[model samples]
Target: MRVALLILAVVVGSVIFNFTTPFHLGQIASNWGLIDVTIWITFVLCGLAFIILGILMAWWIYTYQYQPGQLAEYEPEDPVLEGRLTILTTIGVVVMLAPGLIAWNDYIAVPEDAIELEVFSEQWTWSFRLPGEDGIFGYAHNKNIDIIANPMGIRDDDPYAQDDLVIETNIVKVPVDKKIKVLLRSKDVLHDFWVPEIRAKMDSVPGMVTYFWFEPTRTGVFEILCAELCGSSHHAMRGEMHIVTREEYQLWLDDQITWAERKAGVVPLTPVQQLGQTVARDNGCFACHNTTGAAGTPGPTWKGMWGTEVELDDGSIVTRDEAYVRESITNPGAKLVKGFSNTMLQLSDDVTTEDIDALIEYLKTTTPAVE
Candidate 1:
């Protein structure tokens, strides 16, 4: 009797927790609410099975109380009972699997009118590219990846590569209520693009491009997390995506620089800026930070950064002096700058003390002296 009662208590507690617990899916911000439906369907089917079996076990325990004079009856096989159990199992399986099959069918069907963009993942950062006025993407090759002209490996001679808009920062912006198809490409190991609120995710495999589409139904900031473990900094590989009004998105898009402008040497680099730029590119600093503009890079921009008192994400302020710059370059993970991540890979043997000094000198020249 005690055993049966204990089993009953477990079942009741589990069911109560399921219904009363505050833990549930967050608010759906995308059109893929069907994914949620599929998940719930699976939970319900499995949960019902668990509860029913538990209750049946408890009932049998209660019914078959031990008796000193009672002899146990052995029934090797019950064809009728077995048949009923088999049929019930089949029904339950079908009920659980049908929704997933249906959801997958809808998952691949991207709308024809969806806007197209490319998302590129590296060791620990996310970058993006969107088709320019041409509305077409050019060919790309790993061999052509240049630290200077084309960091994204867009073939310079290819006409289509000319006007591609590059967003080196991981903060993606999309218009609300529009289907957006994102092409996933990876330069290094495996990575997965996932946004919990959007309920859409896809693996970014190297040597190939994978894609998925979703319509943003709400306007808010959503986090971009790497669902797959890529490397040591996998946990720190985070980004932001803002869903906003159409007008706001367009305005933001217009402010971005195009490939042609970047390639044409339009933003002429000063000798000091040029040296710093070369050092940064060669050392893969631009992989997380940008030097061309004021703000876009996952790491803070190099433009106007020097001689300015900067505030960190932790609400701490530090002057970008020689000492701070030295510490930041050699031991990048040592400081946590506001609005940026500590995912910066450490550079010890690769970067010497002299190289750091050169980089500091170049960085100082990137920003002009304030009058």
Candidate 2:
């Protein structure tokens, strides 16, 4: 009878102990920083508790039996034992909490030398702005947008904005080991900017600004993804982040500023031309509309979309006259253009009529002469 009881106790203890231990260890290794340390401490404490419980169970099984004159020793209450247990439990809690509090404090303290950058999120893309050499960024309003001078709608009248660098893309780069603070805003829907490696994320809501900060400890490429499911292409709304040394970061910044300036100098003929360029660039149209005219783009060549006969969305064909082109530019849904999906959203509300005309003219002039 004793041998059978001992065997049962060993089997049950082994099963429970083996099952619980590995799960705790796996959780501890998955996360980083203070959380990971706290998890490890908790695992140790729980393991100790399980061992003590197991000992008590083994004693009960060895001493107690259903037969007459066979019963386990029972201590109803011992003040000293209770007091020692209380102290041990208190120590375990404190040990787990200390690192967590320290990490929380570190997370809240903004570094004095942190770099500030603003991130703007719209329906499906991210745009970034960094202060220029003066280390200041001025205020901007959507209403202040002068289509000719400032496509980003920055308020150039503000003296502090004289050299602010703006970029329209999802990619962001920062120097490793330097804290970076990002001001986030959404132009359309709500989105979350998340980077797992940095353990940082923040919500970008329309009509409001939110901010988050983090420092990359290692130099590597990381992914920036929209944590919230904003729309259809949410999964595809991803970008790359390059964490480089300070010198490499500086060189990259300089090149970005110079490229922005060069692009700014390429004046558009009209607001429509500007709108077309902006939409085309933002929607990755350039991948297919390159000057080299590679043939796999799956639609009528944007190289010469204007002044050409395009089949309509309603199964009717029409000459690409000014009116037809204007209609196509604004209400892309109205004309399917035969081969392409009408995935292009209605731009009529977003762009003015004059802008549409300008875009048409620009398209007419820039069409590649394919022989």
Scored by TM-score, the top model is 1
Per-model clash counts, in order, read 2, 4
lDDT of 2 at 223: 78
Superposed Cα deviation of residue 267, candidate 2 (Å): 9.0
Show model 2 residue runs off by greater than 4 Å.
Answer: 1-32, 35-101, 141-153, 258-371
lDDT of 1 by residue, 230-269 (tens): 9999998999889999987886677567888888655433
Name every residue pair that clashes in candidate 1.
312-338, 313-338
Task: Please give the CA lDDT of all the candidate structures.
Answer: 0.84, 0.67
Cα lDDT, model 2, residue 19: 77
Whole-model lDDT, model 1: 0.84
lDDT of 1 at 50: 88
